[model samples]
Target: MKNCSNFTNDVVYSIIISFISVSCIYGQIPVENDTIEDIEDFDIIDMESTLVEEKKDSISWVSDVFSAMRLGIQYGFTYKAEKPDKIMNNRFSFRLEYSKSFLEYLSVHIDTKMFTFLKNDHRIRDEEDIVALEGRTREAYLQTSFNKTSIKAGIQIVVWGESDYAIVTNEIGRLDYREPLSLNMDDLRIGQPMLTIDQYSSFGYWSAFFVPYSEFNEQPRKGTGYYYDPFDGKVEYLKEKQKGNFSEYGLRWRKTFGKSDISIMAASLIDNQYALRMVNPDLITKSKQRFFMTGVTFNRAINNLLVKGEVAIKSEKAYNDASFQIVKKNALDASLGVDYSPNSTFTLSIEAVNYHIMDWSDQIQGIPRNNYIALLALSKQLMKNNLSLSWASMYNGPYTNFFNVLSASYNWNDHITLNFDALIPIVDDARSGFYPYRDQKQVAFRVLYQL
Candidate 1:
């Protein structure tokens, strides 16, 4: 069975590679209606009449092919924040996008990223830069209308919550935490394949999703400081077929009335939050496991301030035992956040969250029964909207640990921009989340050109 699964995976990957290679070589283009060589086969007057009708409603595929495309390039580098050393992330990347409307009811969007990274260090390079070049389809989806309902198919991104900087109700997509707290939530999500259906009415909107597969979070490499390897290097990965039953399915209902918006959502998905989890008494899991999450969220504008709140209960999550086996448990989390933009150039926001474990035992040593996290964010724009500065900090109240970041960006022009960011951590206990990343303080800069 294992051999067969490996063969199937290899074939799928090989087919994908071949498809990309052929596409790059051929550069297939849409056909123009007026460029047909066999014009004698059709009446010229009828063709002209059809063209006129198309101009009134439908768009010419030839002219619409690349009309909505955007392409750009960026270069970035990163180093230790406090102590300058050799660059850890030396990157040059290409960003591409193409979108077009086939009809009033149908549309398509494509986004892709290709990048390379280089590291020359002995220890770090072995684990990270082993594969310096990578490419992936960020989003390639087709959306169409079915009566009053709209459906989207293919690989795409879906964010399902209101609060920022923390995960309360937004647990759908696979998150990439390779750099941990160095990056924000927006940059940490990875697209996945799903079928989404949305329907809107005077009362509210309803959404449903059927996801065929699930994925684990992309964590730091084994040699990295934040890598979670309780077994040092001994771990086992379950066969792909063994995980075939872990399909993800979800539903959400949202409503807006007056100045307030509310939603309720539920999903059966894998718990990808934990990077290292034990699967059995003798084995540890190399990927995420099954879990269920149900939550409610709300947001409202109260005069000058906007408030958002979420409460989620997750079940079937695994907790490690002293003997190394994992035990399934339930956890509940509640959070509230409020944001205020006193003026056009400045904004302030604060969030508070509390988590409780329904099933607590002595084997869960590092985790507390009742834990809390507090967060604050501030941003300001200067120089007439060209220069911007922002700072965000998150405090783990139970452990007295903090994660802070400060960023500055300047838009040189409509076509060029520059960004600088720093990540700093404060840890007082070894069990804190930031303790693993304490030595990972880093500074990064990027220059981007919009094409």
Candidate 2:
């Protein structure tokens, strides 16, 4: 299986290179001028002037396309260590992406990634193998005029809302949840294979997506985890069941008025489910469960002060024996924040979040308490956009604990970049039963390239 996956990956890379080579050889030679002959034929008194402006716009558009396709590469090293236990690790990663337009109304984009890592160093007897294959498709179907309306399908990213540091329904960030310790990707939002319609006018933009449920199953689960209850001495072991199907429908509307922008999104996850089976055969029969989430965001820039916020509510219906369980869990998560930028090079931001479990009723005696988190961050750009530094502190109120993070990034060019991130635990009075590693201090670095 590994060999086959690698072989397929190599083939895709070769195709990407071939396509870029052909495009470079036959691509149109951009023209520099500001007159459209057809427009000059019009009878209007100012026809010649209007035609020149239109021609300039056409020339600039072609210039932008070629610049966007320039090759770039990034490479970096990341190291993380937790004291006492000697949890030392290192990782290396690389990425390549290309973008070009076949015509004025059609464009294409492709991205490929590679990651490798060494876990626990020599402290552990065996080395861990870590790698991932990721690819993206964008602008496969597009057509537009001055109004900027277009249609797109295939794997493409859809970005909406105005929250700065946090995203509510970012599927690409979902991968980070699977590896909580890894450095976050900047474009953490990725495109699933779906059909999208976008329309833009003087007011703003409106977009909608029609994604089929079947395409989401491209990734498979390797195993399952067991959940245990110490207070009641109960254990629930879940096994992977047959993959389920679900479709996501989304709509977003945004408008910019003066210095402020307002946007809203409505999305639904239909027929979502996870495979589940209890350790005890007599407990209950297996069945599919459904879950859904809804979110909204707003942002405004008032002079030196910029503010943004988002709120989301998620709910899932209980199935099998879960319905009979004494304590069910549903959640509502929200965040509000503001940033003050005294200058173009420096900014300060403060944000607060609440993760409230709606099922936390007094009648449910053993349930975990809701959580509140607050964060403050300051950032500075230096060396003419080559270097950036940021510091952040977060307090998780429910546990009466705090965490601090210091991070920096250096962009050598459009292709190569480097990043450094560190996490420090200032307070660790978290709920006793949870793993202490969640509150441990660690640091890591990463480098990336595009070619």
Candidate 3:
């Protein structure tokens, strides 16, 4: 993606693109009403009446065309607590989506997003500038359905697993880690291009996917508040490029029984997280290793309580030693969560996660052999469900790191919404990833309008 600093033009361009693309792709829009008249009893008055009806029909068609398309726009900003006058993020975003069914068994969908970063400052590095105009096609796909089977191709988002807060098996889609602590959970995923086949049978629902060109996680740019500096001194960094092969595939089978759901999945893929390879004390390179992973997830609802868990085993995972040398080891990841909802307006969720490296070694550079994390979330709605309030907290067991977020959202009406979020990070150990921005507490405000 290319970045430009023209904010007004970018916003106008996004609006024009949405309308033009939708009109062009649809070509002929179907109208529901048909005006009929009698020719034998026609006169000048009847002719004028018929012409007026035709004009109304034309207006109705245009209205229907515009109403059928989905459009949304959002503007938000974050303010740092330490530097009250400084703005951390000022973003304006637009989204457009259009879907159509061409045949009984074939359909297509297009979703696009545009973002304009209105903040320009020193924190935004020149090497990888984050403050500018950017756009992406969130999803553009064609699908065919036959009886109990369906096939889809194009850019898409796939979600797998049952645990919340901790990612155990939902590794198929890449995640955005650029502003890890500030982003909402629902907006953290980035779409990937792939072909998928899903089949429904008496046994279960089977799904298989092939990603020809898989992508890695979106990391923070250098000089950003969230960027992590591994080495203190200057070091040369290099990334190894894959020559010709770029493929990742996975299979999943899910079944439902009463109020319970279970799924098992396996994949051969390159890790999204990179490992450092030390060329020397002053040189280090970021690289990813291929690995095999298999996992299972299940969720069951009982009374007012819901329980979910996931466990995965990965072979030949990549890691860095104390000397920054690369090492391969097996690892196990597991997470369990429980939700208690006493009423429709209030809910609480608690989760625990663990990551263990087999063939343990104390020489691991950043991660401990056994890492544990605890999470808690509570949410409530009031004002006839127009106002929502939530609080989420996370704690690292070994590092004594603590992170918390408080959020509130209010619906002004059917088309407008206002949101506010506060993020707080307490770093007890310098080894913790959150230590880099220990003093960067922030409060964010957002307004969204649907068109």
Best by TM-score: 3
Find the 10 residues in a row with the least total lDDT in model 2: 217-226
lDDT of each: 0.77, 0.57, 0.81
TM-score of each: 0.80, 0.66, 0.85
- How far residue 92's Cα lies from its native spot in candidate 3, in Å, is 1.2
Q: Which candidate achieves the best lDDT against the true structure?
A: 3
Which residues of candidate 3, in runs, are more than 4 Å off? 1-64, 83-85, 120-131
Better of 1 and 3 by TM-score: 3
Q: Per-residue lDDT for 111-203 in model 1, tens only? A: 988877656421244654554676767789999996779999999888888877778788888787775765377778788889999999887
Candidate 3 has its poorest 10 consecutive residues by lDDT at: 34-43
**Which residue pairs clash within candidate 1?**
none
TM-score of 3: 0.85
Q: What RMSD does model 2 have? A: 12.7
Question: Which residue segments of model 1 deviate by more than 4 Å?
Answer: 1-63, 119-124, 127-131, 223-228, 234-244, 273-283
Q: 363-428, model 2: which lDDT tens digit per residue? A: 533224566778888999999979999998867666676667799999888766788888776555
lDDT for predicted candidate 1 compared with the true structure: 0.77
